[model samples]
Target: MAIQKEQIRTALAHVLHPEKKVDIIALNMIQDIIVQDKYVSFTLEMPIKNDPLTQELSQRCERAIHKFIDQDAIVDIQIGINVSQQRQTPAPEPMGSPLSGVQNIIAVASGKGGVGKSTVAVNIAAALARNGAKVGLMDADIYGPSIPTMFDLFERPNVTVQKKLIPLVKYGIKLVSMGFLVDVNQAMVWRGPMVTSAIKQFMNDVEWGELDFMILDMPPGTGDIQLTIVQSVPLSGAVIVSTPQNVALDDVRKGVSMFQKVNVPVLGIIENMAYFSPPDAPDKKYYIFGQEGASRLADELAVPVLGEIPLGQPIRESGDNGKPIVLDNESPAAASFLACSANMQQQLAIRAATMPKDLSISFTEKSPSAHT
Candidate 1:
């Protein structure tokens, strides 16, 4: 028999929401259900905005449908917030939020940690800023907020008028991170809800003025944290970062699949540490992790390969010094980042020109349930 909507719903009902401690179907969370010939789609309405459990809920739904149907079947799930009618009072606006300043908030993410994802995010923002585009960097990796370190901002963030927090400025880029306010040693113990709350506060309370790009330095892996951040902001698209090694490539597929299931348009893939070139031997390139794993992955997924960043000491030193290699016009690493920025701009232009217009989740405060 072909897969039925009731069959998928029944299976989902068996998988309880881990945090809510209730079956997803019973909680009135599954708002709509539809099944095509070989495609299954549903929307899981969350009770709270940026709910950490929603990410887990998405995976369970995917698993249940895949188990009963074909493993290759297409599953589309969107996480939305259910409107609460009981509350009489309205919620106040959020501060230091990325959606406030940028039209398109793109998260640079990875499947597994330690793939130099933050470095790519920071440099990408720097390259974009240097090109006369206003940019902001939000260090959304709550437990491991590295944007402050990347920008070399040791000073604490201050509150602005309207009682919102102002982002730190460096090399013409505005930035915010938990590293500036919390004790670095204590953040690791934060629970799921605490992390989600912090991300909300960052987005709602921060004063990010006008920006062309607000790059979120997302946490690694397809975990609760990643999902929470995705649900918290209105993202223009997602850029997956990965190395060319086999293990990293395997996890990259999972990361890509997560975005696909959620219907987030993947901008492209950025292969960091693509190769290593000695400072002295600029002409020589060594393939430290093999060749073009990310490019091949892009081919398989039918997304563009944005660019590959070669591994080099200057790239590391520049990041450590709070200066992006892109600022050093003569360096090859700097040139590569500039090229990548141009490629990204071209891709955006192409999308705007060729793609049909549709209503995506809005970043405006009016649509609180929209995905960032």
Candidate 2:
């Protein structure tokens, strides 16, 4: 059977975009259709770079050609990301909030606890600071505040004449946390409204003046506290943190869903404690928590895996000593944290069209993971 351009178009017309619910031909997604000796090749125009649907849609087009056009035709599909024809309007934010001056506000969250989400949040903030970006770290985990002990801040926040609370500065990053307000020995015994009130105060009552990035260290779990915080603040995007374990990856789905339901773009995922490496044998890796669990999940979700941080003693020591691991700049763990932070911003550049372009500007060299 002789293949024609019109016949190829007819076959592709049967392929529909899952999200837009429109056939590729009507959407103008198929182009450069060339037919030679039954070898069919064409460019598949995707709506955005790194779209999760890129693979599935490309496969569908290939199958459509084989099943509908010619069973023996050879299919070669290439993907090209297209700038949206119509730019989406930015979502309206809460009026009169102090976050107006912040360039980008992102959340570091997890589906379940004990995934080292706070450690990742604190170190990412430190990496940004090391690159000379003005950064702010907020302990959104009202019940289990870790920023105070992580940063070793114990001084009570001072009030401005306007009655706004002044955020404390350490290591060139502004920080605020419930840990600073309550006694070190006491547990935060409060209701949902009280927790929401404290978070609102952190956003509205605190004086976090002009920052390049405001990183929220969100509490673990996808529950009422998490929902309340997301509703209370204008988050630019979110980063899901999980260990390379199936149990943790299960919760990661819930966390990602919560953000997606609220219209927040999930920038990427960070696979924490992916493996363990010994100082004596740097080349050897031990898969202590399972192998490539988060990577598989990211592939299924169609999001980028920003980094894979190895489990190590330095990370724990730095947290216990009130200094994040990235402060040591000479260590391998610092390099990993810095790279993860950079790749995350790269997603903010490519996936998040609603963010300011300046938010994607990299202070350091490009990240290795951004290639994905």
Candidate 3:
């Protein structure tokens, strides 16, 4: 049988506070109790920050749960104290920006995988760099990092004198990937907290100085990593990539809605795999996935159709060769990514022009919720 909240609560109730001579339940030190199959997690809420008894009580709770409840129960007790005071702390003076030197942080995201999201991201980064904009591409897809393979970057990022990670430079674009830090052959077996922590380290600890744009190749979906990015960084905007098919467009809608809910502006949509053209004909376009489905959806949403990328062999080969197709001036596929980059730049320009002067980009500081 799966673990129940009440059963775990009953076990935690057995642990008494040594200083207060009362159970944690009576002291109301527990909040946000969660239970799953054999996994249990709860917040060990305390009244003050860094209480000396915090660690002691946490261990006791673990022991009590094992002794009184399921011996095999996996427990994750997180400390969350000083709620009232932390909430009331004044916002620190303009710390510049969370990602200090990066001018624009754009996440290239898709609702589902296999829609060629990363391809679009890498090429977009390359195109932006080709135009002489200082660009950085962060492979935020922790579960299935492809930037290392896509950019042919095999070495780990060097650490600076200040202990910040020095992102490897590739073809003039700075790059970072989870693939570089771990054994490449080993599969990442990580949970939500672990994934979030690793991503936070990528954003906070990397030496990304004075970038014109930081392109984040987000994991396919609106999950923990996406949420953490939106909450942690002041994203200038997001570009939704989708195939020209209803199934992919359906998730694209969800992705759009998720960004809307978080106040991150959806820049526009790039219809990848919008069509396939024969190398021999060079002009014959086949609507294998359906025609302009993403563009129609973009029309419905009143957003711009950035550009349509056709499926091509050279594009794939370029990724395999550790070079973006955009570097090839003759490849038609590269033309598509460059056009998309231009449209994206135009959208960013529009957003900048209409910005409220009083508008603080740090709108996501504590959170959109904290403001409410």
Candidate 4:
């Protein structure tokens, strides 16, 4: 019988990836298979480039084709790397002239609550400010604004002579939060529209003057309010925060999907509460959650794992004291946050260099309006 494509594919299915432990066909690595008279050509989309197993996989595929085809037939196998692309959707409406001067606006998000999303946002902003970048931190978590407590600032934002609300300053970073507008004890029992409106007002009414970067402490979950805020602003990118646990990583995938749907590039993932190490025995490491969960997720998503922050008492104390651990040079958490900040800055710089100047700041369809 003449050679058939299905027979060749069945043979190739026996070839498995050594690390992923799955057949190459099941992994969807095989693409663009073509069969002509006495000739066969196919492409292998590898996840990693220059992998040590590339040669082995190539030989295996050639052998598989030889088994089904005539002895004199030519079999051509092309090996190439495949990069994953984010899901695409229609871009959001153009944001008005609220954040014209801000070079980049980054949202720090999580799929669920209590993943240290706000803490990561605070420390990253503080680290950038320390590095001499003009930074602003806006608490977009209207229901649970923690920036006020994180920065230990209770003073209400002042209305300027021009009728604009001025963002409070702490740790050399401009800040705004619902905690500053309402009593800390009161619950924000507002609906979706109200919450979205408040976030819009925070973006437009607040006079955030000349910021190099704005770190938005986003609320947890992928709800309407989250969609509204993201749609209302021209976010440069987003960073997802999650613990080193399967549960947290599952939610993280949803968060990443939401940003991808909105056409916002995911900067990377931050693994918080990654591990624990006693001060007396710093060399010893303990994985309280699963080991390398976030790192594996990042790899799957084709994004970088910015940093793995260890769980420590000093981090909790600094948060409660309204002083982020990044400001405390003596703490180990400070070093971790600094490293994360550096990685984030490098990513931002690379993005800026590659993107067209006009496309760098905003991702809306309409032309940006003049600053009002």
Candidate order by lDDT, decreasing, is 2, 4, 3, 1
Query: On residues 1-372, what C-alpha lDDT tens digit does candidate 3 reach at each position?
Result: 877898888888888878656678755567788888878888776665566877788889988888888889887777765333111111222555437677788889988998888999999999999999999998888889999889888997789897889999989999989898997445367776777777788888888778889898988988766877666656778899998879999989988987766666788999988888998988999989888788789888877889999998888888888899999999989888999999999998776544321211221111111110
Error of 1 at 326 (Å): 1.3
Shift of residue 117 alpha carbon in model 2, Å: 0.7
Of models 1 and 2, which has the larger TM-score? 2
Model 3: residues with Cα > 4 Å off, grouped in runs: 1-98, 184-187, 357-372
Whole-model lDDT per candidate? 0.76, 0.82, 0.79, 0.80
Tens digit of lDDT per residue, candidate 2, span 1-372?
689999999999899878667688766677778899889988776666666887788888988998998888888776655653221212433555687668778899999998999999999999999999999999998889999889988899999999999999999999999888887345467778888898899988999877888999998899988987986777778899998878899999999999876657788899999888899997788999888788888989887899989899989989989998999967888889999999988887665532321121112222222211
Q: Is candidate 1 or candidate 2 better by lDDT?
A: 2
Residue 303 displacement in candidate 4 (angstroms): 1.4
User: lDDT (0-100) at residue 220 of candidate 3?
Assistant: 90
Clash pairs of candidate 2?
A: none
Candidates' TM-scores?
0.70, 0.72, 0.70, 0.71
Provide the lDDT at 205 for model 3: 88
Once model 1 is optimally superposed onto the true structure by TM-score, how far is the C-alpha of residue 325 displaced, in angstroms?
1.3
Q: Which pairs clash in the backbone of model 3?
A: none
